[model samples]
Target chain A: MRHTIPPRSGAAFTLERGQRLTVIDPEGEQVADLLAFSRSDIDEVISSGRSLDYASRIFLTTGDALYSNRSNVMLRIVEDTVGRHDFLLTPCSADTFRILYDDAEPHRGCFGNLAHALAPYGIGPDRIPVAFNVFMNVAVDGDTGALAVRPPLSRAGDRIVFEAETDLIIGLTACSAPQSNNFAFKPIEYEISS
Target chain B: MRHTIPPRSGAAFTLERGQRLTVIDPEGEQVADLLAFSRSDIDEVISSGRSLDYASRIFLTTGDALYSNRSNVMLRIVEDTVGRHDFLLTPCSADTFRILYDDAEPHRGCFGNLAHALAPYGIGPDRIPVAFNVFMNVAVDGDTGALAVRPPLSRAGDRIVFEAETDLIIGLTACSAPQSNNFAFKPIEYEISS
Candidate 1:
């Protein structure tokens, strides 16, 4: 079924093994932060380190399997319209606004939204790990190791599909951080199918 | 005071604000994983993304300050002998051995050791975040964004010193992963001074 997560908000749901989830950027240049946890054990949450270590690449796309903390497969990307995703960044939070943007009134970013959404599933903020930032553009300087956030390349209707490898609880957000969304927030659409 | 963390083991201690922590590679080519939590609030742990975001560089060394999740200063690097360290990767765990090394008898790596050492302080495994990996050589390919674990360059007596910016709970480990230590395990020494 199709679901829309309003701009700067998040949602959490369950997906059985073999199910598919498609996250769509309905508006151009928006980013989504995705996270997965094993349903049988929340402690076995998705791990960016394990996935990147095994994949040997930071940019994960079609055919890449996101691994759990216990080395188990949680989700495998089967389709990706925008291959440039960021695995290095933690979800932007209230601190992000306070520190990076120097905003006088900081909105709780994706991290806080996810924390609230996942709390019903008994997942706390501390349980959250680095997210698979869908369609987010980040540039890393090869020499100095400095990082810069760039505007996403995803256009309207761009989507990424993931096939669940195990029973999972997924937390997803329409990123609230201004830089990640190119300074504008938009809704994110997702569909789940068996 | 000086303390030794045996090879493949870990320790936890407290440091008052303004005190200095000097982590020493007593034996050549060893790596140490370091973590800090605010003594006043365990929820506000050290954050790799915040530190890297503010610093704009990943190879943290002398003159760098590690930031907490709340964007507060946690530890400031007052001195560093070996310039290279890893902030991108998570602490190596049992899953790392199983998935990366394919070991029949996988040893719980630094993650497990830190979890054990910090459990007494009410810090669970889930609370652990990406550690500041001292003397760990990680090469990130500028073009492909691929990462490789390389041998540390720290020789005997090499040390990195951090001045506590707040009262903190510190977890330190002599990394168990062979690749990080140049295929040899060795004890790590640390001293604290006001």
Candidate 2:
């Protein structure tokens, strides 16, 4: 089924093992933060560290597997049009705006959206780990260890497909952070296939 | 007073504002995972994203402030003998040994140690975020976005000192992972000065 997550909002749903989820940036230059948890045990959530450790690379694309904290495969990227994504960053939250941007009134951002969306599945803010930022472009300078969040290279209609290796609860957001989405927000589309 | 965190173990303590903490690599080539939480609230813990976001560099040394999830300054590096450290990786855990090393009996790594030590302060396993890895060396290839964990550059008596910016709860570990500590486990020493 096709679903639209409006700009600056999030959604949560369950995907059975072997199901494929395709997340699309309906509009170009948008970022979507994605989180996955084991349907049976919320404690076994997607782990950026384990996935990165096993993959040995930051920019994951088709053929890469997202591993859980328990080191179980959760999702495997089966298809990707935009290959650049960020797993090194925690989802932007109110603190991100208040601290980095110095905004007096900060947006709740993807972190809050995920917490609110996943609350039905017994997930809390503290349980939210670093997210797989689909379509987000983060450039790391190897020489100086500096980081820069650049505008995504994804054009309109770009999508990444992930096949579930286990039954899972998924949280996804059309990121609200200005710096992440090129100072503008746009809706995201997703479809699940058996 | 000097305190020794025996090999592969951890410790937790409270630090009043302005107190300086000196974490020493007493025997060298060891990694210490450090975590900080607000004394008033456990939810406002150290944030790697915030620290690196603000610093614009991954190699945090003297003059850098460790930030909390709530965007507050929790600790500031006042002195550093070895400038290389890692904030991009999560503390090693049982899953790390099992998945990465194929160990049949995986040791409860720094993550477990921190969780156990900080339990008295109401912190749980899920609350532990990416830690500040003291004296650890991590190499990131900018072009490929690849990461490699290398042996620490710290020699005997190398230390990194931080001054508490607020009343804080601290968790420190003499890392148990063989790779992080150069295939040898060693005790870590710490001293607090008011």
DockQ of each: 0.54, 0.54
Backbone clash total for model 1 is 0
lDDT string for model 1 (A1-194, tens) is 79999999999999999999999999889999999998888888887767887887778899999987667889999999988898888888987888788988888899999999999999998777789899998888766787888899999999999999999999999999898888999999999999
- On TM-score, the leading prediction is 1
lDDT of 2 by residue, B49-73 (tens): 6688778788899999998866689
lDDT of 2: 0.91
Measured against the true structure, the TM-scores of the candidates, in listed sequence, are 0.93, 0.93
Residues B1-194, candidate 1, lDDT per residue (tens digit)?
A: 78999999999999999999999999889999999999998988988777887786778888889998777899999999999998877788887888788888888899999999999999998777778999998888766787888999999999999999999999999999999999999999999999
Relative to the true structure, candidate 2 reaches a TM of 0.93
Error of 1 at B81 (Å): 1.9
Ten residues in sequence with the least summed lDDT for candidate 2 chain B: B48-57
Candidate 1: list runs displaced more than 4 Å. none
Docking class of 2: medium
After superposition, which runs of candidate 2 have C-alpha atoms over 4 Å from their true positions?
Answer: none
